[model samples]
Target: MRYVKYAAIRKPTEECIFCKARDEVGKERENLVLFRAKYCLVMLNLFPYNTGHLMIAPYRHVPSLEQLSDEELTELMVLTKRCLKMLREVYRPDGFNIGINIGRVAGAGFEGHVHIHIVPRWNGDTNFMPVIAGTKVIPESVLDTYDTLIKYTHLLRE
Candidate 1:
């Protein structure tokens, strides 16, 4: 699976992938972390549904938003807005699919660490590739996308 591409780095032994990304330092580029806020951080999705796909998660290891304090919740949404603006500025996508999956059944890849997904969509971006060949093509590489967006990290700070 394309998701497994990150397994070598986000090993099963790690307590939580998001926590690891939150704690680990000096590897922002390698980890695809674009920006770090007081309560949340932004990073490109390793197995993105589309180009410029990004995920925003709180620094805390809470599994649900209800567990987060008001400050955390506020910053989470604030950062989400920043991400949307940044994605729009950089990718100029036709539309977007923004959501949070709370559980495994709900499509949370990391059920124990809640996060929001921001997927950029274009008209007719989805084609027969996935239906026929069982593969989705991303026009740009994740690292390349990170590099392209990293310059705009300052937007999140403001």
Candidate 2:
């Protein structure tokens, strides 16, 4: 990963979030990233409820789902299913939350382009931490999770 320093305070350049990831193939110490393809890529969420929380995003920058072509939509769905399958195989979550947030008000962290979130859920996965502390407890680090998923990208293609 190329390091970008702003003034005296250094921070990863946010020129284009996806491009930053694209440029650094092996630089990220975190293992949360799972797969990358021509049209889309999958990465484990740094903060997640369960162990495997993945996000699938398009290579092209499109803010709304309406901006995506039929082919892009098709590919997105296909990738989403594959992600779910791989998560099931690895973590065996009982259910999943799969959808896209069109705008910031809709809960899109990155509003420039629409991406799909695939969150795995097990029975009684929600607990007091979320209800009381208002924070989620994730057992694994994003980097470790990425390494695990990267090892299983082949199964997703199949």
Candidate 3:
């Protein structure tokens, strides 16, 4: 039998997690952050829909993408594409769901901080688990996914 472990903790802070991650260094593994570019950074989603679910956010804590500078916008796309490549090489997903949820009304969990989601998709990925229990069954742990993806992040710089 296989079991999935879920770690749910509440962090009481006014600071955004992405902002905290930017300030903290040498803690990528802990943060589930795979790569850091000049303007944007990639991190594994704490609450993921699939195994390779990633989020690319900029250093600035802006509520909307429109607030981002031209450089931030450009680097955000580049890093997001790199993340997709890494996901393809590691998970070999059949397809992907990539987009940004603008506001709380649009299902943005972090409506205060804009980030793009890159969720890996495969054939027949949807199951009745979520429909019945409202819980997503991710096959792998966030740390394991981070470990796998981090190895390929170096290739992005090459």
Candidate 4:
């Protein structure tokens, strides 16, 4: 809920990524976005630490968690749970790293809107490449991951 100054500067753009995805429902597949709903959308992280690094972001174009209504907060949390379910079914990951980066200094990529991250993890998933080359290995391509997740979104709301 900490208001960051930089978010104010980036709020002018009409075609914000979250807004655009909200308008285009199933087209998330084209954008590597795994799923989209009324209050939030799930999109793959272009630069991820693991294979299925996805973000659940609110549809409203606002910065900081404090800006969200109680209903919006409820929907966002629901979408977060759905994301975890989809990832569990598709990736079968042993664990997950889930959180939010609130401000620019706190590593919020899109500081204009608060989002939750759900990153799937597995045993021995990290290797020498990440340690030595500063590159994390992803077993599947973003598109493939998108396809895998999109297939499971149908059962998510249940």
- In order of listing, the candidates' clash counts read 0, 4, 0, 0
Task: State in Å the error of residue 25, model 4.
Answer: 4.3
lDDT of 3 by residue, 22-67 (tens): 8888998888888888888888888788999999999998989889
Best TM-score among the predictions, by candidate number:
1
Prediction 4 global C-alpha lDDT: 0.75
Q: How many angstroms is residue 27 displaced in model 3 relative to the true structure, after the best TM-score fit?
A: 1.3
Q: What local lDDT score does residue 8 receive in model 1, on the 0 to 100 scale?
A: 34
Candidate 2 per-residue lDDT over residues 1-158, each given as its tens digit: 01111212433234545545556678543434567676776776555646888877777788887888887777888889988888899989899988788875776656676788888898988888867865677777777787777778997676
Q: How well does candidate 1 score on lDDT at residue 19?
A: 89
Q: Give the clashing pairs for model 1.
A: none
Ten contiguous residues with the weakest lDDT in model 1: 4-13
Query: How many Å off is the CA of 126 in candidate 1?
Result: 0.6
Q: For model 2, what is the C-alpha lDDT against the true structure?
A: 0.72
Cα lDDT for residue 140, candidate 1 = 95
C-alpha lDDT (0 to 100) for residue 121 of candidate 1? 97
**What are the TM-scores, per candidate, against the unseen true structure?**
0.92, 0.82, 0.89, 0.84
By TM-score, is 1 or 3 better? 1
* Root-mean-square deviation (CA) per prediction: 2.5, 5.6, 3.8, 5.3
What's the best-to-worst order under lDDT? 1, 3, 4, 2
